[model samples]
Target chain A: MVFEEINKKDWEAIATYLSGEMNQQEAVDFEKRVAASKENEAYFKQVKTDWEIMENLKQKNTFDTNKAWGNLYNKMEQDGLLDTKSSINKFKLSRLAEIAAIFVVGILLTTLLYYIVSDTTKKNWQVADTYESPEIRTIKLSDGSVVYLNAESKLYFPEAFEGDVRIVEFEGDGFFEISKNPNKPFIIKAKNAEIRVLGTSFNVNTKAGNDRVEVLVETGKVQLTATKNKSIHKVLEPGFIGTLDNNNIKKEINTDINYMAWKTRTFNFEGVPLKKAVEALNRAYNVNIVCNDDRINNIKLVSPFQNKPLDTVIQVLCELEHLKFEKQGNNIVLMPK
Target chain B: MNLILRRIQKGDLKAFESLFKELYSPLCLYANKYLQDKDKAEETVQDIFYGIWKNREKLDIRVSFKSYLYKAVQNNCLQQIQHHLVEDKYKQYVKSEVAHFHSDPAKEMELQEMNEVIEQTLDSLPERCKEIFSMSRFEGLKYREIAEKLEISTKTVEANMGKALQAFRQNLKQYVGVNS
Candidate 1:
C-alpha cells in the first residue's frame, strides 16, 4: 500500500512490529506486506532514516547536569555569593584540633606574634619571602590556612598566625584557604573591606586603581563586611560571590566554578562577555588582548582552557568561532567575522 | 513542550536539573560533530543551559523547545571558537595537554561528512517521521523506548522507524548502491 493509504493505526502497528513488540503472526504478516510492494518497502526505509536522524538529534540536545552544577557552584563561589563560613569554620577547627593539644598555647602565642610583627614591621621586614611577578605563590599559614597570592600581588602575614584573631593584609588578587579557629576568626584586610572566614577557599581581587573589591568562594563559607561599617556584613556559602564598590555591595549566588580556574593555570569562561574574557586572558598571561571590532568585543563565549598552547587556542577559535586574530608581539588583536 | 517552557521560565531548579540531565549527552554529541572536542562540546552545552537560566525571564519562544536549545548550543560553540582565537595568540604553549585529547583528524573528518549527510537526510523526512526517526537512531532508543517516550503505541514506533529507514535508503541511494 502507498504511504498515504496507510491509516494511523497501521502506522502504529508498523512501529510496534519494527520495535519487536508484536507477536510472531503479526511479524510474519508485516514482512509479507513489505515483500508485496516496492512502495511499502520504500516507505519503510524512509521511516527508518527519519528515526535515525531524530535519534541523533535527540542525543545532541542533552546537557551534562553534574558538570553544569559543579560549574555553577564554582561560579557562585568565585562571585562570593554563597555562605561558606560554616564549612571554613569546620575545616579550621578540625585542623586546630589536629595539632598537639599540649603545645596549643605555645603555637597560639607564636601565631599572635607572627601577625603582630608582620603588620607592625612591614617596611623593616626584609622581603624575607618574595613572590616573583607573574606567579601565584601559595603560602601555608601556621593554622594550616593557605593563601594563593596572584601574580604581581604581595601579602604580609606573620611567621606564624597568632593572637585572638588571625589577620592578613593583601594587595592584588589572592585566594585564601583559612584554617578555622572559632575562638580566633581569620580576617583578611584588603582595601576597604574585611573578609572573615573560619576556613574557606575564596578569591579576593583588589588590584591597584580598581575601585571595587571582588570576592568569590569555592568551598566553605565567609563573612565580608565593609571595614568602614561593621553592620554591612554579608555571609557567603559555597558557589556564592560578592562585589564591593565604594558605595555599593552586590551579592549573587551559583556562578560558574571556572571563575577561579586561574589558580589552577586554567581559565574557563561560560557565556562570558568578550570584553571580560579578554580582560581575564590579559591578566593570566600578562599580555594585552585587544578587540579591534566593538561588535567582536561584545560577543559572548563559553569554553575552557588548561594550559593550552597559544597557537592551538587560536586555531580552535578560528575553526570554531569563524573569527580572525592578529598577533602583534605581546598584544593579540581580535576582529569580527 | 509548553509545560517544559513554563517550568524552565519559572526558575524551577528541579525542572532545570532534569532538563539538563535529559539533554546533556545528546547536546555534547551534537556539539562534538561541529567542534570536534568533547570537552568543548560539554562546556558549550553547560553554557547554553546557564544562559537559559540567566535569561529565562526575558526569553521569547517561537519554536519547539528542542529547536531553541539546539540553536543556542550552536551559537555558543561558534562563539567559543572565536574567543579562543583571540586569547590563543597572546598566551604561549599553555594548553598542549588538552589539544592531545581530541580525536585524530581522519576520524573527525569522517564523522563530519557523515553528520552532514545525516543532517540533509533528516531535513527531508516528513515532520513526525523525522521526529520519530531522530528519537530512535540519534537517541539510540529502541522502538519500544521511542513509543514510550513519545507516548505512542509500539506499533507506531515500528512503522515510523521502517518509514525512516526507507526514506534514508532512497535519499542516499547513490552512496548505498556503491557501498552495498
Candidate 2:
C-alpha cells in the first residue's frame, strides 16, 4: 500500500498553524484534515516537537535561574527598595516568605541585616550571608568557632546555636577552625556532601559550577557524608582528605598541602617543580601564570612566602630561578634569563 | 490578559517575580538564538526585566505581554549584534556562535543514539535554504521580512521554507512515522 506524501499545501497549513497565522476558517480546515487521519495529527505533533527541540537547543545550560534571581535582587537593593527601616519592619522579611512577597530583595536583606545586627541578642533569628571571593571573610559563630570563607562562597548560620547540633549551610569553599564542643557537633551542609565534626580544623573546597566537594582534615576528625545517602560516609583523620567527586566518595592522603593558602596568604613549596609552585601561586593570587617551556617544569623551587603581596612572590620566584617574567593582562609569563 | 502582568503593573514584586519565572527561560532561549552566547543572553534578558521592574508603573503595554517581552528581547539582541559589528568583533561573534552551536556533545550523542534521525538530516540542505529556514524559525521573522532582508521575493522565501520543511520531514519519515 502506497500513501501520498504531504504536499506544499499541507506544509503551508503546518507553517500557518505553527506561526499562529491561520484564520478561523483556515484553522477549522486544518483541524478537519488532522482529525480525518491519524497520520496528519502525528505529522503535526512531529513538526511541533521538532520546533521545540530547536528551541531547547537554544537553551544553554549556563543560565542558572536562582543565581540570576540573586543578581536581580542585588540590583534591587541598589535601587533603594530596602533603604528604610519601615520598609524592613513592615514586610517582616524572611527568605521563604520573600519568595511570595511583593517586595523581594528588601524582604530578604531586611531579614539578613536584622539578623546580622541583632543576631547576638536574638537567639531565634538565623542569619544568611553570601560572600564572593578573592574577598575571604571571617565569620564568628555564636559558639566561638571561626570560619574563613574563601572567595565565591556562601555561608548561612544562625545568630545563636539553638539546637543540639550547630549546623551551617555552605556552597563553594571555606576553612573551618571550629571551637571544641563535646556535646554538640558542628556540621557544614553543602550541595552534595556534609562535613560533621565535634571540634576540629579543616579545609572544605568545592568549585562553583563543578560537582566536586573536597574536605581535608588538618586537625581533629571530620566525618564526610553524602547529603542524599547518610549511610555512605567517610571519617577522615588529620592530614587525610575525603572527596565527593561525580557522586563517588574516596578517601585519600591530602597531597595539595597548600589548601589553606587562600586563607593564610602564605605558600610553602619545598623541592617541588616550577609547575607545582606556579599552580599554587595561581590559586593563591587568582592570577594566571604559565610556564609551558619544556625546561620550565623540571626547575625545582623550595620557597616559603608568608603574607607577601602577589608581585613580590612572583619577583622572588623569578629572581631565585634566574628567570625574567613579563605580565600580560592578568597573566605572568616566566622565561629563562 | 496575564494576571501576572496586571499585578506587576500595580507595583507588585511577587507578581513580577512570577512573571520572571514564567518568561525568563523563554526570553533567554530566544536571546541566545541571536547572541549565541549564554552569558550575554542572560545579561540581555536580565537587563530587560530590570528595566521592566524599574518602570513597571509606567510600562506601556501596546501588545500582549508575551509579544512585548519577545519584541524587546529581539530589539536588544539586534542592538547587541550591531554593537559587536561596530567594534569589529563580528569575527569573534561568528566564532563564538559556531562554538556554542557545536558545544553540546550530549545533544549530539542523543540525536545520534535516538537514531541517525535528526542530526545529519540538515547537512544536506543548501546553505541558503538552511539560513532562510533558521532566520524564519530562530529569528521569528515573517516571510516578507526575511525576503526583504535577504533581498529575495516573498515567493522565493516561502518556496525555500517549504523545501526545507519537506526535506526535514522526508528525512525524518522513519522517525516521525510519516507513512505508518
Measured by DockQ, the strongest candidate is 1
Interface RMSD of each: 8.8, 11.0
**TM, every model:** 0.47, 0.40
Tell me the deviation in Å of residue A187 in model 1.
Answer: 0.9
Judging by TM-score against the true structure, name the best candidate: 1
Candidate 2, A1-337: lDDT as tens digits: 0126777866765765665656789889878878787766666777766655555533433466655765775687578642335465656655446455656656668747644754464456454444433766788888999987776677878777764678787876788999999899888888788899999999887862388898988999999988767558888877667888666787755566566787787787756678988877776666789877969778878788899988898888888888988887777888898
Give lDDT for model 1. Answer: 0.67
Candidates in order have lDDT scores of 0.67, 0.72
Expressed as tens digits, the lDDT of each residue in A149-239 for candidate 1 is 7777777776665456777787777888877677888888888888988877888888624678888888888888887765587877666
Q: What are the candidates' individual DockQ scores?
A: 0.15, 0.13
